[model samples]
Target: MREIVDFDNLKMYINGEWVTAQSEKTYSVINPSTGKVVANVPNGGRNETKQAIDAADQAFKSWSKLTAVERAKYLMRLYALMHQYKDQLAEIMSLEMGKPFTEAKGEVDFAASYFEWFAEEGRRIYGETIPSNSPNKRLMVIRQPVGVVAAITPWNFPLAMMTRKVGAALAAGCTAIVKPASQSPISAIAFGRLVELAGIPNGVISVITGSSGPISDEIFENPIVKKVTFTGSTEVGKLLVTKSAHQLKKLSLELGGHAPFIVFEDADLEAAATGAIASKYRNTGQTCVCANRIYVHQSVIEEFSEILVKKVKELKVGNSIDPTVQVGPLVNREGLLKVEEQVKDALDKGARILCGGKRVGGELTEGLFYEPTVLGDVTPTMLITYQETFGPVAPIIPFESEEEVIQQANGTEYGLASYFYTQNISRAVRVAEALEFGIMGINDSIPTVAQAPFGGIKESGQGREGGHQGLDDYLEYKFISLGI
Candidate 1:
């Protein structure tokens, strides 16, 4: 990838001011692919977070008073600025998080798309008048901003997740404070430049980095914050859900995912193979919605496995900067170890590894790069069959019948995304309906987009993230009755 942006010491953006932590301490952020220090991000504490929350709280009064159209105009400008700096944003994301250059650029587009989409959606935030039983009475419902919002984003898709939450919140006329994951904070910090260039008020959008735990505690306890939006693990989400109950603050949690990908006997062999590969290997399978459990009809398991292994072998595993690299390193050491554990546990339990099951370390460099692995004879008993192994490992589980496959697929705590390949129209519709997941892809590998509502159910997570309902989490309804 061609380099374009300068990586600088990004301090915390709080209360319309660029400031460091009260203690003047910082933490080192590492590039996963190169194993090099990227920058020293501010180690913000309660003091810094208090400043951000206070700014957002104060700004909300004027910011929410603006017409949706006015707020949307600011978002439109933001969208344009995001495009203007797309190359730089992509480079920063790739350097910070190790996504392939091409993929990072695509992520830039996906993130910017939310601003453009929510800009239009903001203008259409409509009010409705209900028919009154009495002639002198008038009843109506109006939508309003949910007040100050705190968006906690994950490291997997730093820029996109930040925009997904912050864009919608801003469009809903809510001021926001974004806390990016410690693993990758540069993308979130650099995004402040675009918001500033767009002329959005400083407190209307703030990006804070540092000790997220203390920052979150202050936000949760403060009465100024009205909503908490998070995209991370279910464990942490449950903790937030429990703590947010103190003030009963609204919450939007897009948590963990253990998605299932199914391939029936009637599926196009080539399509099924490539679709599974696309869903499983993207971001080296670090995505929450990526296919973790794959089910293949017993009749076609051999051919499906054969074609999948062939394609998995063809993927070029290298640094994210390499344009030709299809698979990149894991985000950190924990991710690398998690993948290693899943593969080891599966192999120990009698699962067969067809290709690429070990870590790859080049002599010239040391990084967290694991081979794109494929496992066969995966049983429901194996840990890899149900665990959310967020790695580029495709474990094909054979099923005897449709009923059995659906039973196996839905037999998990997560219900984020599910996929199945079938030429049978009726069967496709039937299985799609039966699968217990928020997003379903029939004959499709990837189904998420800016225009759709993306989220999960059960233990996967709660609430929606995109499309018309994406703004729903940021707005509240008020009913009015007038007597004349």
Candidate 2:
């Protein structure tokens, strides 16, 4: 066994074992930056998924019985190891997921923080005694882990999202089987190496990569998996919802998001533009929290757009491994195609391409890289504004009144995040309160933190993923009564 992970050939982790699929099935992990094969991974189908699920189930009996303090030690160890290999982990993510090297490194740090945060949180999982209504009666409520968890994370932010679910679930004394997105499964496998180094028990953590259909079926049907945590598209989340209903599994779905970035007339133009750029282009705008719609007041739209386009033009798009590059390729060909379609639709609906609307060419021709695009003359009917663009394209729409902007922002069914910049304290407070979203950024660009509650509302998905509330979804409460 090589101590250094080899993405050229990868294996699924099951019951503390790194092995290939029993059926010898495999899928190639492509480097989105090069359109080249990075590695071939086990296409762990139903049989493989079942093996991981069973391993998790068997481990759960003893793993869940461990004291919360004991479990935290393993998580802390994992966190330390994650930090030690942070650079290597970031490189793998950059290659596999098409994130800029700098952003990839940042994601590794974010991932480590989740484990470190949860390590401390594990010991704090407390219960309380209830006030009995009747004399000579005692009542208490206790929290317990919700058994085995199947955490399905997306290609975007693969490492951080997986850790977000696993850290909290494991901290709650629950075992987990991670099914990472096929496009970026190596990051998940690399994390499994850290879990192994942590000296955690066998079967306590598992990773599987394969087609979603067969793999998802086994995970949902497995009676041993009591809870499921998923972060992906809302449509897929809905499918999981229907599938998990047969077993009534505990579900935490952090699904789709169409975040709105609103800049008021009175906002500091520099800060407003900077916030727009950071919020809109991080992860090349694939993040669920990425600003999808840029709503600037009619009074300041021109100035804001000018500043934003200047910054956007300065962004260097290239291979993700280039440290100086600020923008990278989309995750895969489909992502590129989606962005293409959205831009075309917007153009057909009369939206103007202010700076970028086409793909970049040169030595970087092999990758799925799209230029950082800014669209003006964006209308309410344009497809780019209505749908989750999930690209570096920012559509700057104009609004007149605070009430009008709020209505436009809340019009989308997806409400994962909303951002507004205003110097007027009253306007900021009013707009933040009125916007329907799980996360709000009032003048701040990147608002996500390990200590803050992270998630969305309505079709954007359910359940929180961080802060003190992160562990709640992975746990269940039991009430006890005694008559003395």
Candidate 3:
């Protein structure tokens, strides 16, 4: 079969030019499906990160000066280019991140939607004119770009995460320096190429791939960076908060989530089952918002478990290159090990495995593939109950009352996303309001969209990523009072 992407030509994008690391060093990006090298990306460090930051800083002077409508045109062109090369971008994401090609294609469209949404949203950035308290006085509030922004993205959904941040930043007239996760930098590099083709000015956007520590260090220390947006683990998010404290930089963190999927007896069993499968196993459950704990009404636990297991069993697991495959390998061995450890802990704590419980063997043994798992008799004490199991394992816990389940769901420190299925409109409203999570789905499995606000409360991090609120973090609101 012909290769979809030219892996050899990939390089770091800085100042509108493709370049290699100053150290002449590179790192191999491994394909999780086969444990083989996919491509060697530039191993940038502090020096390259600084260069990218400087470029963005310089670009900000012009980029931020442009009218919001003028910036929207560049984003519109890039959005068109993304659709034009969607197949190649999807292929690269699948090879590097080990997500199914179909899903990757969906992600490409999803990523591009941000550019499309923000392109129009930018034009509507409106300032307020407040009534003056005294005669001959005028009061007004206007929003302006926050200047150079540093976006640190994650491996899972690499393209979508970067676009969610960069799109809003650029739309708000901020230049961005992105440090994509080393494991999946190719997608960002490819997007940078599209940015150049869109006729965006030099230094408006830069994609640097390399060591996370040094890159992040440079971002935190640089005074040129006025805002920092990140999507990753809670531990890393906390560290960024600490680092940014010294400089008081604007920050938007979309951190770890331990979402709860509650299934009430009143819910449609078939619909609940399908939603559970989609929520718990999408991207092999590596997503930050993937349902971690499932709380089923005790009366319907058995029926729900059977239906969920049947649907999970129907999912085909294989290499991402396979068009028919629904489930793909974990991003790396560490992710696989965490899944194994969580399963073992649940089993040891007396949870029963209904369908899948162990790693897949045979031809798939070389890859980081785990069977889509379902565990019954799960309790709060079990490791899988509270921890964010970043894998395709569904642990079912039974609850007797709405009050009891609500308490259990809100027990975790992370409150990023939650879902509950109910036929009763009153119960849906009650549960939705009670859930402490930032984002909630009353009956829907996939609730995220380019037009909605996406973020979390509590330890799941702060600030919004989508909607008009998405542009808020990238902008600074100024109030002017003048006496005539």
Candidate 4:
């Protein structure tokens, strides 16, 4: 692939300008597929983070005053630019994040859809006239931007996660300072270049690359930052909540998920197996909502396992740059270790390895790669039962009844997403309602879209990310009362 943007020359974006960290410190961005350094990014600290915040605070005074329609135009431009540079962005993400090129291209489209969706949604931020107790008195409610926003995005789905949060915030008329994960800051910098080309005003959007602790500390302590949006582990989400507590900053967290994929006996076995593979192994199972535990009906466990293992064995695992590869390397050694540990734990506890259960050697690439794993006879006593195994491993447990499956599925503290395959309409409705998750897919594996509300309940974290509800967390409501 030819290089469009100069990744080696990238810099942090602040106040609508390309700049480097004041500390002059830098860190290398490693390509997970080859374990090679792609580029060096500025390792910003508190000073750089504070400067970005100040810039955003200054810009908010004017940015928040623009009409929703006017603001939508900028997002429209961004949406267009994202499409114009779609291939390049995907290439950047694939090279830096180690997802297959095909999957990365799909993610580029998914990320652009957010901007397109919000461009129209911004114009619909309507206020309401309320009924008054007295004829002479008028009551009204209006929503406005929630000032400066701090978005802390994750490494997985780097572009999509940034657009999901920043698109809504900017559409709602808020200036933003983004702190992208250090592992994948190049993608954010590339987006920043687009933001500049899109003619978004200086200070309206800033991308700061740095250590998480210093950036987070500055964000929490800075009073100018009115709201904080984050997507990461549940442990980090809790820490952010605690940090922002004293400041009373508005928070929208999309945290860790231990999603359950259930297969009913009456469902189509082939379709169920296909859906399970799609949901469990996408992006090498690095996604937060990837199905961690699978529950299959006792009657169909044997048949389902056969189909699932066959499909999994056929998955192509190699470097992400290959167009035909489906399963790519883990982002780092840490992730690979986690996957190995989980698989070992399940095997030690009597779970049978249905298909694969080992690390891949460097015949493909000398990077962190683990085989797409499937474990049968998984019980609750295994570590994979409760922990968020963020890897390419599927642990299948047999369930005798619908009630038994639901109980076991909802047993986890994390409830971001859940899926089930059922042809019976009544059973579908009953189970969908009973599942303790913010997002559910009935006979569908991938349910996330730009037009629908995406969030979680229980320990998965709070607030919504997409749809009309996405703009809510970035806005503040004010009620007006007038008497003649």
On a 0 to 1 TM-score scale, where does candidate 3 land against the true structure?
0.98
Whole-model lDDT for model 2 versus the true structure? Answer: 0.90
Candidate 4 has what TM-score? 0.98
User: How far in Å is the alpha carbon of 337 misplaced in model 3?
Assistant: 0.6
- Per-residue lDDT for 120 in model 4? 88
Steric clash pairs (candidate 4): none
Q: Local error of candidate 1 at 451, Å?
A: 1.3
Off by over 4 Å in 4: 1-4
> Candidate 2 at 263: error in angstroms?
0.4
Going through the candidates in order, what is the number of backbone clashes in each?
A: 0, 0, 0, 0
Error (Å) of candidate 1 at residue 70 is 1.4
lDDT of 1 by residue, 329-401 (tens): 8999898998989899888888999999999877415878999999998878888887788888999888889
What are the per-residue Cα lDDT tens digits for candidate 3 across 18-127? Answer: 88999999999999998899999989899988888899988889888888889999999989988989888888988998999999999999999999999999998899
Whole-model Cα lDDT per candidate? Answer: 0.88, 0.90, 0.92, 0.92
Task: Give candidate 1's error at residue 42 in angstroms.
Answer: 0.6
lDDT of 4 by residue, 1-484 (tens): 3344586677899998888888788999898888899899998989988899999999999999998888889998988888888888887888888988999989989999999999889999999999999999999999999999999999999999999999999999999999999888988999998899889999999999989988999999999999999999999999989999998999999999999999999999999999999999999999989899899999999999999999999999998889999999899889889889988888898999988899888575488888999999999999998999878999999999999999999998998999999899999999999999999999999999999999999999999999999999999999999998
Candidate that beats the other on lDDT, 1 or 4, i.e. the better one: 4
The worst-scoring run of ten residues by lDDT in candidate 1 lies at 1-10
Q: Candidate 3: which stretches are off by over 4 Å?
A: 1-5
